[model samples]
Target: MKLHTIDTGFFKLDGGAMFGVVPKAIWNKTNPADDKNLCTWAMRCLLIEDGKRLILIDTGIGNKQDEKFFSHYYLHGNATMDSSLAAKGFHRDDITDVFLTHLHFDHVGGAVIRDGEKLLPAFKNATYWSNRQHWEWAVNPNDREKASFLKDNILPIQQSGRLKFVSAQDGVSFTDDIKIKFAYGHTDAMMLPLINYKGKQVLYMADLLPSAGHVPLPYVMAYDMFPMKTLDERKIYWNEAVEQQYILYMEHDPVNECCTLQQTEKGIRIKDLFKLEEM
Candidate 1:
């Protein structure tokens, strides 16, 4: 199996929202914010080439939204979904599965594309993967998360008859070497893919752990529905990551692509940081 980092681009999000209760004095040291309190973040995606299946995890915020909508989150960078795919000698049609960790606009936006007036699935021949519970929650989003779950980015897959719901069972095998782990704190039933690559396990840190800055226990995102739940989940996973020596594939970290945790006197902290290709 081969894994490639598909960088769609970078966007700015409020640092305060990204670092929950963590003070700016603390988080600023890692993710510095601009005058507007917005910090730049990478909308990094992952491509998995396993035998006959080419699976893509998370489509970074697509370029379909209107000017007014995009003005809110400044999307910048030369890398694009198509360009990144082409770099790997692949195309959108080459993808067999799009495994969405959640339905947030920034994560699933590129799943669909704007074709004139109609919204369509970006991966024409690929089956869009989502879970039943998260699908329902995203479609009928609560007021707090409504803005993040855009209909243009989601409904098209179901409308196109290419959407499939994976089993909600935790640790369920999505493929022979890929297992799905579910976390609820970030959003309802957010799916994290645990992939076995080169005889080692790699955990896709969707929003469960957005960046190395979030390695410390209290650094939960304000966007999480249940911050306390996230804390508990982190404690459990952090220890497992250290014990099992799992490589964490980060989605939103601008500089760091992957990292491993080490047990310290305080708690679990990053042992080393490196790119996925280094593996």
Candidate 2:
């Protein structure tokens, strides 16, 4: 089995929103913000090639939104979903499965594309994977998360008849190497893929921990619906990761692609940072 890092692009989000309750004086030490208080973040996804099963973890915000809508996020980057895939000698249609961690616009927006007068699955050949719990929560979103769960990015997968649910059971293994770890602080049934890569465990740090800058337990994102739950989740995962020597594959970290954690006086902190190729 092999793994590929697919960088969709980068976008800006409010620094305050990215770290709730954590003051700028603190978070800015890691993720500095612009004058407008917006910090740049990458929408990095992962592609796993396991025999006949090719799984894509998440897609970026995409290009279907209007100018006004995009202006808000300040999308900026050269890498894109298609071009990045092509760089690795793969194509969208080559994907066999798309395991979405959640249905946020920045995560699942690229799952669908605009084709003439109709919307359709971006990877027509891929069976889109999402858990039943998150699917229902995303489709029927609450007011706080309604904006993030765009209909065009989501409904199309189901409409295209390519949607599949991950086994609702936690700690389940979809393949011989990839296991599922569920977290609810970010959203209901947000599944994080735990891959046994190169004989080492690599945890895909979804929204539960978006970036390396968020490693310090208190740097929780305001976007998380349950900040306390995120704290507990991180404590449990980080400790286990450090104890087991797990590598963290960050999804939204703009500069760092991956990292290993070490127990620190300031709680869990980065032990070493490097590209996946370094593995």
Candidate 3:
């Protein structure tokens, strides 16, 4: 099996929201913000190539949103989903499965595209994978998360008859080597893919741990529905990651792509940082 990092480019988000209760003084040291306190973050996606099945995790924010809408989050950078795929000698049609970690606009926006008067699945020949719980939650979103769950990005998959729901069972195998781990704190039933690559494990840190800056225990995101639940989940996963020696594949980290954890006196902290290709 081969894993590739598909960078869909970078966007700016409020550093305070991304870092949660952590003081700007501390978080700024790692993810320094701009004059407006907005920090640039990568909408990094992953491509899993195992034989004929090419699975893509997360789509990043697509280009379908209006200019006014995009004005809010400044999307910059030259890399895009199409360009990144072409670099790997592949195309959108090459993808067999799109495993969404959640239905947030930034994560799943590229799943669909505006085709004139109609919104359509971006990957014409691929099956879009989402869980039943998350599907329901996103369609009928609460006030806080409503802005993130755009109908144009989601409904098209179901409407196109290419959407499939993964079983709600934790640790369920999405494939022979990829196991799905569910975390509820970030959103309802956010799926994290635990992939076995080259005899080692790589955990896709989708919002559960957005970046290397979030390694410390108290660095939960304000966007999380249940911050305390996120804290508990992070603690459990950090300890297990250190014990098992898992390489974390970060989705939002701009500079770092991958990291390893080490148990320290205070708690588990990043042992080393490197790109996925370095693996």
**Steric overlap count per candidate:** 0, 0, 0
lDDT of each: 0.95, 0.91, 0.95
lDDT of candidate 1 over 1-279, digit per residue (tens): 999999999999999999998999999999999999999999999999999999999999998999999999999999999999999999999999999999999999999998898998999999999999999999999999999999889998899999999999999999999999999999999999999999899999999999999999999999999999999999999999988999999999999999999988887899999999999
TM-score of each candidate? 0.99, 0.98, 0.99
Whole-structure CA lDDT of model 2: 0.91
Q: Clashing residue pairs, candidate 2? A: none
Cα error, residue 211 of model 1, in Å, equals 0.7
Span of ten consecutive residues with least summed lDDT in model 3: 148-157
Clashing pairs in 3: none
What is candidate 1's local distance difference test score?
Answer: 0.95
After the best TM-score superposition of candidate 1, give how far the Cα of residue 248 lies from its true spot, in angstroms. Answer: 0.2
lDDT of 2 at 269: 88
Which window of 10 residues has the lowest lDDT sum in candidate 1? 261-270
119-208 in candidate 3: lDDT tens per residue? 999999899999999999999999999999999999888999999999978999999999999999989999999999998999998999
